[model samples]
Target: MLSRISKKNLLVAAGVFVVGSLIGVGLFTFVYAKGISYLGNDPATCANCHVMEGHYDAWLAGSHANVATCNDCHAPHDNIVSKYYVKADNGFWHGLKFTTGQYPENIEIRDSNRAVTNEACLYCHSEFTSDMRMTAGSDQISCTRCHSDVGHRKR
Candidate 1:
């Protein structure tokens, strides 16, 4: 029976097997990685990776622990769409880095994330920042420049 099968049929079977195997492995990896946790606002989810343990611990000891979670300070507050967009974008890059073990020893925020964090700072402290914004004119100020440890104080 195998000898009678056409070459085209064998190729089709091999292709299907490869595609199915890839999808199966991908889904298994996702489930094993706790992929769904990334969608929520729970700060504990951020600590799923060992690399984030320090940051999570710091946040627990930091001033913002009583008032904010990781997303509150690191994600955009403009709207739900932008908030999730940043989360998904960051999630993808973080997943890639963690999987490849290619991240820096001392992780630093990217410029785009810094902008989101600055916006978050402004959003929370608008009353205090409004006057400062006006005085600065066209220049934009970075909140983390001076208050970098507010969200992740060293324990």
Candidate 2:
């Protein structure tokens, strides 16, 4: 002997649930598309988050702004193997840091990784043959440390 709700009431409840789900899906899709495009862009991408505004501003003021984006210099990427490795490692580190709310105010590119960045520079600057080492005295060393002209270029 159980009491049941009216058919009209059940139908109305189901309709409301479906409508709510559709709206949520639409909102999520919109935000996701916007976020993806922003992160992939040269300017809007950097401005998407407050943490990178300083670097973005400096890059805009620098000589390299015309040539490269923040991802070009800081993000690890290249051929399939190298690109996969860098992207995975960076993704993991950033994901972990982001989830923990431990955003780094300052980050330094490793010297070993700088060698890879240098190779990319040399790929574009095939004419330049001389080798450059990360300056011994500097705490942070990378392509930009010496050749500030090009965000991803070598001197």
Candidate 3:
């Protein structure tokens, strides 16, 4: 009976240690990666990674620099839930890629993110695009398809 209790105690201790270690490592990585900064609308947060330096610099010099932010153009604005969902999803993938150094040399927006951006463009430029949107029928129009350089012009 005593040996059984000792084995159970040992198992509990090991479980506690494992869970604690995981939490500790997660906290450390969060702080080291400036994970909290990604929650805000700051464009500088996007530049935390070295790969985004050029993109951040281009945004600073772009026409929308004073008017919009990285989130405004990139994240969903349909609702709070969708916005945070996209942010969290993107954050996880970006963190994984950046940490593993497995990202592409030229980072291109994914199709889903591109859809979000197109919606954002339409949201902001609704007045001008209202007619076009109505006449386009079933075809989807992408703002970036024509004005790709508008947000991140080459330096």
Give the top-scoring candidate (TM-score). Answer: 3
Each prediction's TM-score versus the true structure: 0.89, 0.52, 0.94
10 residues in a row with least lDDT, candidate 2: 146-155
TM-score of model 1 relative to the true fold?
A: 0.89
Better of 2 and 3 by TM-score: 3
For model 1, residues 1-155, the per-residue Cα lDDT tens digits are 46546777999999999999999999998899998889898999999999999999999988999999999999998899999999999999999999999999889899999999988989999989877653256768688888888999643
Q: List the residue pairs that clash in candidate 2.
A: none
- Candidate ordering by lDDT (highest first): 3, 1, 2
Residue pairs in clash, model 3: none
lDDT accuracy of residue 69 in candidate 1 = 91
- How close to the true structure is residue 52 of candidate 3, measured as C-alpha lDDT? 90
**Poorest 10 consecutive residues by lDDT, candidate 1:** 132-141
Which ranges of candidate 2 are over 4 A from the true structure?
Answer: 1-35, 38-43, 75-81, 111-113, 130-145, 148-155
Distance (Å) between predicted and true CA of 36, model 1? 0.4
- lDDT of candidates 1 onward, in order: 0.90, 0.60, 0.91
Predicted candidate 2 versus true structure: per-residue lDDT over 24-44, tens digit per residue: 987896485354543353565
User: Which ranges in model 1 have alpha carbons more than 4 Å from their true place?
Assistant: 1-5, 134-138
